[model samples]
Target: MNASPVTIPARRGKAAFVAAGQSIKVINTHGEQVVDTWAFNRADITEFMSMEHTRSGSRHIIPRVGDAMLTNHRRPILTLTEDTSGGIHDTLCAACDRYRYEGLGCTEPHDNCTDNLAAGLAELGLTPPETPSPLNLFMNIPWTPDGEIAFEPPISTPGCYVVLRAEMDLVIAFSACPQDLLPINGRAGKPTEAHFVIA
Candidate 1:
């Protein structure tokens, strides 16, 4: 309810392609929420991201502050930029639909999560999900010593933001985690904010 002053009616699940030098700021209007992010060279989406590239170069499955988030090509797509709470954000958790949620305990049918992701791509004029895995921004999944990851509480506070300056002409897509069963999005459900400022 206390989103930043910017008015973006199409905020949820929307893909926005900020130009080569633009900067976008994501705000967690509510504290301890998770958001997912992915970037692609505007020239070609197929030449997109790969898990091997991002995880190998930085925070592994859990991204930390000031780390470089690399693309599959070993190029820096985005720097960690800023992290407030230092809570772990997952690079391993995939977006969940009703199918995936059923196991997580959502017995009824719903498609909002996938719809939110699709909203951005649709607005960007790109096709459906092509990347094998998505890069989650504020979501937390605690890493175990045995090499397993667990979804954990959010590390961000209200108004905490991560800033990304476009390294290339990038089509950045993000989802305010619509995880009804997950803690990061706030099980109560509220709107998240995305603000684009020209770099």
Candidate 2:
């Protein structure tokens, strides 16, 4: 493990390898930025973390500490070991892509999580077979009993974080989500950087 925390630059992505039994501490540095997270088997990128599989296995919309995040093949890849960020995270939202921004009326190219994931993996001379739905950390998406959900500012405070233990040797990736058009990042509509430390 490195002695220093690594930055997930604002509106960008970062990835690293985590051996089985290692834990990653993801910090909500600014209290507002939502980090879209993914994990892939070190030996086979095609067998990546699957939020659907995890949800089915855990039987929860929002994973709690102790929940095992499963891979596409129904194997445990990561486990939620600790959470101090108000225990709010999303398991249903798909990573943002160019089409997402375009639908929001952006005429110019936007930095998005899908592209971010590819870029992060590319740095390690790796590539994901496909973009999977991400575990959105510190994201606030409240739902109604009737099934309606709305994006809202995160309730987590600065310096709060969550720790996830790797159940298998894998590559973990993160994106400091850049959704300024919505308050998901914050009511101020500003995106910020986050940090992570492996231990």
Candidate 3:
């Protein structure tokens, strides 16, 4: 892993490799950007992080520090080690894709997390077996007792971050989600760059 912080540019994505026991610190540089995150087994992309499986394993919609993020195969991939970003994250939403923007009335091609994931992995001479539901870092999705959920701006302040320890040798990806149509990024609807450091 690079010692310097790696940028996940606004409206784009980045990916990296982490060995077991290593940790990655994801920074919300500007505070409001929703980073769509994913992780895969370094030896087998098919065995990737699974939000549904993690939810079943942890029994929590929002993971807290010390919770292990599970893979589709029901094994640990990454574990939440430390968090300073208000403990607000969404594991329920799928990564934004072209069809989502299209439904939101975009007539032109839009930068999206799905594409960004592929692009990021492509940079490492790899491709995603499929787009899995991402761990939406810094995203705020409030739910009601009636089972309704609403997209809201993040509550995290600038420079707040979360650290996830790799449970296995894995590849991690992140997209500084380009969702300007909604306030998921912020009320300003401006998606900004984010950063991560592997240590």
Candidate 4:
């Protein structure tokens, strides 16, 4: 009943969409970093989220500890419900925009992550935005059984956050990943804020 105070800067990435009463919050003011999330429906987006139908219906596709970021038609777009990094977070990991710019070597234009996802999908108005397929919240990317997926470190810290309470009507987007070559934005990256609640 008290979740509001979003300072989500530090290599930022932001997106919002949560109805059915409403709820959205993300905090990690400093201490490892990674925030990427996407849950669709918002009327319908070709029944999105089909990473091969979530690894063939939840056999395994990231999100550990009780896992439930379920999708791929199974519904329920988030259910890790609460975690403090213990479960780690990151669905494979994909947030280094500008064509991943030489795999994030840095050209120094500032405001990366596809410009915070085109300003978080231009606040839903989408002036010049039309690119979907996302869901990253708290990126960690660590899995190498030869498949490969390095980019580790950063399971959230500084007031870690992860809360979801919506079962329908959603269209989330996030970017808290302005990457300067990447370190989960902890090298000189700063400036973040996101807060919303409606019980």
Q: What is the TM-score of each candidate against the true structure?
A: 0.80, 0.99, 0.99, 0.29
Model 3 agreement with the true structure over 1-199: per-residue lDDT tens digits: 5668999999999998899989999999999989999999999999999999999999999999989999999999999999999999999999999999999999999999999999999999999999999999999999999999999999999999999999999999999999999999999999999999999
Model 4 gets an lDDT of 0.57
* Residue 127, candidate 3: alpha-carbon lDDT: 92
**Whose TM-score is higher: candidate 1's or candidate 3's?**
3
Mark the regions of model 1 whose C-alpha exceeds 4 Å error after superposition: 1-11, 129-131, 187-198
lDDT of 2 at 136: 97
Cα deviation of 80, candidate 3, in Å: 0.3
Steric clash pairs (candidate 3): none
Against the true structure, candidate 1 reaches a TM-score of 0.80
lDDT of 2 by residue, 1-199 (tens): 7748999999999999999999999999989989999999999999999999999999999999999999999999999999999999998789999999999999999999999999999999998899999999999998999999999999999999999999999999999999999899999988999999999
Q: What is the C-alpha RMSD of each candidate to the true structure, in Å?
A: 3.9, 0.6, 0.6, 16.0
The most accurate candidate by lDDT is 3
Give the runs in model 2 whose Cα sits over 4 Å from its true position. none
Q: Which 10 successive residues of model 2 have the least lDDT summed?
A: 1-10
Q: Is candidate 1 or candidate 4 better by lDDT?
A: 1
